[model samples]
Target: MENLERTLSTWIVRYRWWFLILMPLLILVLAKGLDLRFNGDYRVFFKKDNPQLQAFNRLEDTYTQTKNVIFLLVPEEGHVFRRETLVTVERLTELAWQIPYSLRVDSLSNFQHTEAEGDNIIIRNLVQDAPGLSDAQIARIRDIALAEPLLVGKSIPKDGAATIVNVTVQLPGIDETGEVTEVATAARALADEIRAHSHLSVHLSGMVMMNASFSEAALGDMDFLIRVSAGAMLVVLVFFLGSFGAFGTLLVIAMSALAGMGVGGYLGLPFTPPSASAPLIIMTMAIADSVHILATFYQELDSGAGAKCRREAMQESLRINLQPLFLTTLTTIIGFLSLNFSDVPPFGDLGNFVSVGVAISFLLSITFLPALMILLPARLPRFQFEIHMMTHLGNWVVRHRRRLLWSTASLMVLLTAFVPRNELNDVYVHYLDESFAFRQDTDLLDKYLGGLYYIDYSLDSGKTDGIHDPVFLHKIEVFANWLRQQPEVNHVNIITDTFKRLNRIMHENDPNQYRLPERRDLAAQYLLLYEMSLPYGLDLNNLINVNKSATRVTVGIQVLSTREVLALEERIHQWLSDHEPALVTEGSSPAIMFSHIGEQNIRSMLGAMTLALVLISLLLIGALQSLRIGLASMLPNLIPAGMAFGIWGILVGEVGLALSVVTSMTLGIVVDDTVHFLSKYLRARREQGMPSESAVRHAFSHVGMALVITSVVLISGFAILSLSAFYPNSGMGLMTAMILTLALLADFLFLPPLLMKIDKH
Candidate 1:
């Protein structure tokens, strides 16, 4: 392997001209396919066969698709019943139909109100001629709406201080990416128009707005965050290398990123928030290879090798770093490829893209980087301060080997103790920070009106039109009543509400008659009469299927954690088992789906991580040719992840979809420091026949500065990602940075001392 490394380095310099030209040309050709498109749909988070997603799909097929945009109107006067506010709502409701792909629009002014007059049932818009309504009429409207079950918590709050105009858009599903943005844009424009002339404050929230925010966040990160991370890498590069020409490192990384994105494009993957950070991540990971080679090259040059020996210096640098770089790249690719085990498809895309980029970076670092360095030679000033600091650190660790090892081990144990504190939880709306309009509007909506988080159940009755049976209606009413009693539940929109309203209207408007009809025939007759009287777009299709075998019961919930969401789901299922077994069905909604996926992802990644650890350990044992040292390397490699989670548990105490993948994702990265340190330590012991103490010293002096430089670059790169408004990306960034930092410390502090004690005999 040493001879092979020497020969490979010789050839890389001998054909430097060819390597520099041919490699970049090949990369650019591959990068030509790097046409990335953005998709922000919530459904993108789940696989096609994901159970919760399948349930949501079935629910949509049975009833109206839940894709909607809600415009919340908060009047300056603090009441929605005022004439001007009503007019603005009425106008917005009318114009909302103009939004692309709009299937229906529901608002205070367009609420279908049913009443009885002399044995005749009258159904009309609740707030008719809003601009001409008298104060008495507006007061009546408020009184009736506040009393209504269907509209109160959903469209209008109990206090009637705010209202939401909901536009239900039936996207063709053929071009949902474009259609979603179109509807969102139109909705925003309409809201802006309303705010321009009315005292009402308009805010938009719903699935459509959330979807649009996903696209906006991805595009924003692609535009801004990548540049920020690159600039950070640049500063670190210049500060360490002490030369601007060290920028050739950035070019190698950039090409690697471009090639990675190109692979994603070639595979026809969409850029989601998780996957959008691929470029920055590829660049960051690729930097380690370049920094290792460059550090060695600079060190060789500072040994008084003249400019004429620059090629020899680079050749020697490549020869030393080749094996470590290859090992690190292999492990990183393994770690990221493990993401394919994730329940979320975007994460899989991220993993694949990055793995490919890391591979390309290895190829470039060995070939293109070496070739480029010879062509444009960099003259780095001596990093005496950095060198001396590493030397001092090594000597100190050897002096207090026993004490330092114990302390670090103790610290690792203490941090790992907190790991169990992290609970699996996801609140989708909170996935985006308040910097997003959707999050801000949704937060306000949760505060004043009710929850955007909901659990949808498609209650099946086992026969056609069975939903009209008095038994079925009674069961639904019981279930809805039970949900309403739950503290986490804010409102329940069951078909029973419409039935009771119609029944009371049929009984001459008597409040005492507001109950389900006793007989199935009577319930059927009442449902038919109501359906016949309702206007277009205000029919029962959203709640009832054509055959009426099942009905959708949408239970509005508070902004609860994923744990609370799952708990409510369990309670609902348990209640069905106890009281209404035949009506049992899996709850389905974006909130519920998101809740399940986070836990599922964690489990999947655990299996993948176990496999990766085994593969990496075996490879390390083979490469280092020492079974004892190989097994010893696992301790430092594994401790960083546990410690990172422990730190997260102490600070946040919650882990979700993004956080779930952190362990597996950081596994490969943290190993880089371990491999470099252990490789050098073992070399000193075997080839140079150094003592344990001397071996530790040699490891630190040889690879210690390089490890620090690379870790700092990687940490800063991810730290910049923590500033993203998208919380999943931000949390992953924050946690990954923490893990990398811990990895560096473990390698520098813990690994050295442990090796000394173990190898002393």
Candidate 2:
């Protein structure tokens, strides 16, 4: 151990400058190279072989091979079903089909209209020509729309408030971003055309329109986030280090960030929304390490220390800081790496990228920072204000040590009770803050139109030809009716409902006959007639399986919180158990999958974090060679996270995918304070043979200022991130800053007091 110390000391004294010069250059060169070649896709979040994706893809490719978009037409009141509205819908439907990627278009006018002709019904597209339709013909089209099976409830609202004209594009490899923009532009143009010629109001919705809005909003916010985070860091650095020194620190941090991201790019990683914040995270962590080293080095120089003093400062800082820094990095990596277990690809990539970035920041901090300090002037302006402030703080901590302990312990214990259960929810839409335009637009649509959340139930029977069976159809119809009655369900679409509705229509809209056919043969015959009457592009592939053994039922729900979603899901499962036990299995949809994933990740991550804390404690105990000391050291590190999380629970009841990871991550960062404080306390005790109380005072007096400065820098750096619009990133920043600040307090008061008490025993 003595030789190891000597070797570390010798390296710090002799060759620290070399690390400064080479590190930055190496990072810059590598980063640039990697940035030139990176390609990542957002769809990677779904497993490559997901059955839902496969089924959706196959169905999308086959009959509905057209790209679908919805134009929401809302008149200024009592004008949607007028002749003008019918003409506009018919005109846009025709023009939409002529668009480059469009293969087909379906609106009130173009939807295939058919009726059973005895044993068979002929299926054909309606409205052969748009401008050719007379006023009487257009009236007939509107009448057909009101009575159509799928088009009736979907396109024309039951309340007769709005009308949706769906346009389907058929082009492959269409630039998703570009296509949305083009279609939106075209829809707006058509809306303007309608307003010019008639008195009607129109808005757009559907996958294409939503995707366009989402992309635009995400891109704009990303730009703002980058500018804001960078600007905040720059301001903080200038305030702490002054103008000139701040520039150097900025350069170091910038280099570390670039290098980290560039490395990711080089490794063929794409820049995802989650991983886009990589540079900011790396920059914050790097600046934190730089600030600690520079602050301490400058302090020593201001005190009239020469080359020997500079060398000693570097050696002591490293000796004091190395383990803490290493531990922090390790904990952060573990926290991020645990994301690999997540089913979501973006989350997994984020975990891997951040873990790599943290490791890089750690390496550069120790090597590059020392080197930079050597290269720059050894003398720095004396921080007269800070020194006096820290001195006062140190003296106060020593004087009121006992009182501080009780206050801190009481606060921690009280907060611990509120640390909300590690329950998580995967509401992806909620991931975006309310302030975002996409979220605002989504809310408007949900309020005016319908809910955004959707759940798809694939009602499968073991045997083929079971779907057309009347007994099975009746059960599905019963289930659909039950769901429709529930307050949570906004809409439930089932094939049986459509078939029964068609049967009612076939029987001249008789309410009494609006029920399933009694015999399987009659049901099959009715389905065959309905299938033959369907249009060229519109088909029943999405509603029923090829062999007719399974059917898909979709349910849409209004905007709800995570807890609300869980509750609804539980009720749904219970209903399914009581009603159709074998029909539902892992209901597939973005909402359900995300909710399950979020819950699993939260539970697993919490378990892992607990294991990590225990393992870290064991390591600390073994390293210090005292069970009591090792155990005591954990309080300072452990309490901060618990306190912060508890406060978070009380303040923000919902913890999402991001906060789950923070638990393990904050553990690593907060532990740095404990390790630094305890190392100093132990050295005073075992090496210098000082009494416990005296050693606590001496240790605090010697290293207390460094601890305070480093903690402040870390806290400030992380606090800047709280401004991010991304909830996870912002929440992480706030939580980490709070935990670190509490860690400093624990280190100064509770840690030493507890140590003194233990030593007395």
Candidate 3:
């Protein structure tokens, strides 16, 4: 293997021009294949086959789609009923209909306010002709709005300080990014116009705005993070290598990143926030490959500057680096590929793209990087200061190996104790940082109007038109009343409110008649008359099926942790089973889907992570050709991840869908230092017949500098991700960096002493 790699490196140097031109040209061509589109829909997180997604889709197909953009209006005078605030609400309500893909617009002014006038039933807007609202009329509107079940805590809070305009959208499921942008543009323009005219503040939020946050954040990070990372890497590389060398290596890395994103585009993959970080991640991984090769080559080349010495240095670096590079890349690929086991599509896509990128980095490291270094007219930079520092660090570790090992081991155990402290929690709204408009606005709305999390359920009756059955009506009313009593439930919307209201209106506006009809015939007659009176799009069809066999019940609740949410769903299911078992339904909504996905992803990733660990362990055993060494390698390989999670448990204490894949991600990255160190150590022990102590020194001397350089580069790259507005990417990036850093420490401080103790003479 060494001879073949040396020969290949020499041959590439011989025909360096062709190699340089071809590699870059191929990168450009592959890069063109990337489609580069973003998907803002939260559904992008789940695969089609995911049970939670399937349930949500089924519900959407049955009833109306719940996608919407909400505008929360707060008057400067602290009253939505004021003449100016009422006018602003009316104007925004009218303008909201202009948003693209808008299906229905709901606000206090358009709430279909119903009341009794003598023997007649009057149906009209709650606050029409907004400019003419007298104090008495305003009081009446507030009274009606506060009493309506469908409006309170929905379009208007009970205190009447803030009102919301909900614009429900119906997407065609094509070019959704563009549709979201259009709606956002129109919504923002409307908000600004209203804010300028009226003294009130208009904050925007909702499902549609949430989706736009995903899309915009992806593009924003791609634009800002990629550039930030590139510049940062270049600066780090320039200090390690000279300007010319840094430029050449960065070119290889940039091409590698482009190639990875191109693969996603070529495959027509959707870029969610998780997948959108591909370019930055690929760049980080790719730099290690080039840096290892260049730093090693420089070490040998520095001994002599003549052409003959240059050839030998290049040859030696190539021979020495090939196996370790290939092994590390393969492990990384395996780790990322394990994400295929995830129930989420974005994760799977992320795994696939990164695997491709790691492979490309290995290829470029061996071919393009070497050829560029050989052909580009550049002088070697003096890095003896760095090499000397690494040497001192290695000698220091060897001198106090015993103390270092015990201390680190003890620290790791202490950290491990915190692993169980972390609880799984995911609130989709929190996925974005407060910098985003949606997150900020949503927080204000939650503070004023209860909560936005909703559980959409359809209680089924087994037969068509069975919703008219007195038994079904009474059961639904009972369920709603029971829901209202729950502390977590903020508001409950059921058809019983309208049914009771209509009953009272029919009996000369008598308050005692505000109850469900005792017979099915009377209930059916009242429903028929009410349906006939309502306008086209404002009917109950949005909440019921065409056959009327089932009716949708929406329960609004505040955001809760994954465990709390799952427990709530289970309790609701149990309640229906204990009483009215036939009315049970699987809860379905965006919030419900995300809540279940985190748990499913964690369970699914357990098998994938175990398989990844096994396969990597086997690879170490086979590649190192030492059962004892390979088996021991498992400790460092396994402990770093455990220690990282333990540390994370103490520091963060909340793992979400993104963090679930941390084991698999860090599994591969952490193994790079291990493979480099162990493979070099074993070679010294077996091939050179060195003592265990000497072999450890040889391993450090050979690859220690490269490890430090790569770790620094890798750590810096990941730390930059913490700047992302998207928390998943931020958490994943920061945590991976932490694990990788710990791996370096374990390999350096722990592995050597353990090896000495085992292989003692």
Candidate 4:
């Protein structure tokens, strides 16, 4: 290993010009493939074979692959049934059909009102001739809208102050990258036009807008968060590494980030919110390698006897740091690659991209950084205070080893005990902070009409035209009623509602006849009459399949935590099992999909992290060449994440998909400090034959400051990331920063004392 590193360093110095020129050109060539496009589709989070996603796909395929663009119309007078409001709403509903890919539009004006005159059924738009409607007609419209189950909670609020115009769009699926944005753009333009000409306040909210916000939030973070991270990194680097040397470190990290993101682009990975954070994470992680190499090089130059020239000093730095750097880089890569085990694909992309960045950083740190150091007149400021602080800290730990060992151990145990305080919870709407207009509009929609959180169930009766069977219709009605009874349910869109309405209309609009038909023939006839009277695209195709063997029931719930969402789903499933087993199926929707994945990811990431921990421990056992020290190293390496979780449990008490992979990420990162510290300590003990106490002091004096520098940089980088408007990115940043900070604490206070005690045996 030593000979290889020597030869590599010698080659780098001998062919410095070649390395300096070729590395950038290679990175540039890779950068040419950086054609990154942001995809905010909720589907991006799930794998193709994911059960919930598959169910959703099957459900959509069975009927319409509909994406919704809902415009919330809140009149200034807070009365939606007024003549002018009805007139404006009628015009807006007509205009909404013009939205690109719109397959259907439903609003107060377009709601199909059915009536009976002399045994003939009549179906037409509810709000016709809106400009000529008198006060009596407007009041009758309000009375009819409020009385209708289908319109009450789904479109118009029970209070009748606001209503929604929902446009059902079917994207061609050939160009999903921009189709959602196109729909949202057209919707927003329509909204602006309505606001300009009418007294109504229009706010956009629906699945399409939410998807569009994903791209908006991701693109916003890439520009804003990356710049914030870069500025923070610049200040930290210049302060710690001196101006000229810091520039080299910055350059190395920048090139590494480009390499990582370019590799992702070359691999055809779209930038989702999670993956969009790669550049900032890459910059943060890449710094550790450059800092380690440069710290040693500067130390050698300061020694005044270790090297005769800058080139020799760099080579010596490379020789000393090469093994530890390689070990850390490999372990980190292994840790990140475990993200492939995640249920969520975007997290896997994040992990893979960061792994690439870490590898590239290691390569450039040893080659590009050193070559540039040799060419540039780089002079780093000597930190006499840092050395003195490390020296004193080492002495302090030696003096109070027993106290620190017990105290830190007890604290770690106490914090680890609090780990269960964290409950798995993810709310997709809350993923974006209030800064996003989508979130604000969604909140308003939830406050007014109904919830955006919905669950879709495709209930199959298992035979042709089985939907008309009295028994099947009864079960559907029972389930819909059961859903309506749930506290979380804001609305239930069921075919039973239409059947009851049609039954009453067929019976000369008798109020007492507003119930399900008792006979199969009657139900079939009612459905046939209703479908025949409906206009094209407004037919029952969305609710009932062509064969009438199955129907879809969509239930909207108030905004709730993912834990609550999953609990409601469990309750629903249990109800179906107890009462209607044959009609039972997994609920399919973006909300349900996200709800299931957060729990699944946490479980999978833990398994992956456990495997990574085993592999990393074995590597440590080999690298340190001391089974005892390697075994001891696990104490510090593992405790930091547990302690961080404990702190999070106390502070936040909620773990989401973003927090699920923190253990794996921080495990790899925190190991770098332990490896460097333990390696230095073992060198003093085995090679110099120093006592354990002396070895502890030696480790602290040699590598303690480097650990601090890297920790501060990493922590600062992620802390800046916590400022992101996107919750997943911000939560990850905050949690990672917390873990890295704790890792440093464990390495400094706990590792030394534990080492001294363990080695004594």
Which candidate leads in TM-score?
1
Worst 10 residues of 3 by lDDT: 303-312
Which candidate model has the greater TM-score, 1 or 4?
A: 1
- Listed per candidate, the RMSD to the true structure in angstroms reads 1.3, 4.2, 1.7, 1.5
Q: Give lDDT tens digits, candidate 2, residues 360-451.
A: 77777777767666566633655777667655665677677788778878988998888865345556665557766445645555665463
What ordering of candidates by TM-score runs from best to worst?
1, 4, 3, 2
Selected candidate, larger TM-score, 1 vs 2: 1
Task: Identify the runs in model 2 with alpha carbons over 4 angstroms from their true place.
Answer: 36-70, 91-113, 116-153, 165-222, 266-270, 305-320, 341-345, 421-426, 461-463, 505-512, 518-522, 622-625, 686-690, 698-702
Model 3 residue runs over 4 Å out of place are 117-120, 305-308
How well does model 3 score by local distance difference test?
A: 0.84
C-alpha TM-scores of all predictions? 0.98, 0.86, 0.97, 0.98
Off by over 4 Å in 4: 305-307
Query: What TM-score does candidate 1 reach?
Result: 0.98
Clashing pairs in 2: 67-169, 101-170
lDDT for model 2: 0.67
Cα RMSD, model 4: 1.5
Candidate 3 lDDT, 21-129, residue by residue in tens = 7988889888997777777788888887878789888888888888888898887766788888888888888888888888888788877766667755677778789
- Candidate 4 lDDT tens digits, 217-317: 88899899888888888988898889988899999989999999998899987788899899999999999989988888888888875346989888888
Q: Considering only N, C-alpha and C atoms within 3 Å, which residue pairs clash in candidate 1?
A: none
lDDT of 1 by residue, 565-639 (tens): 899899999999999888878999988998888888988998999999999999899998878888888899899
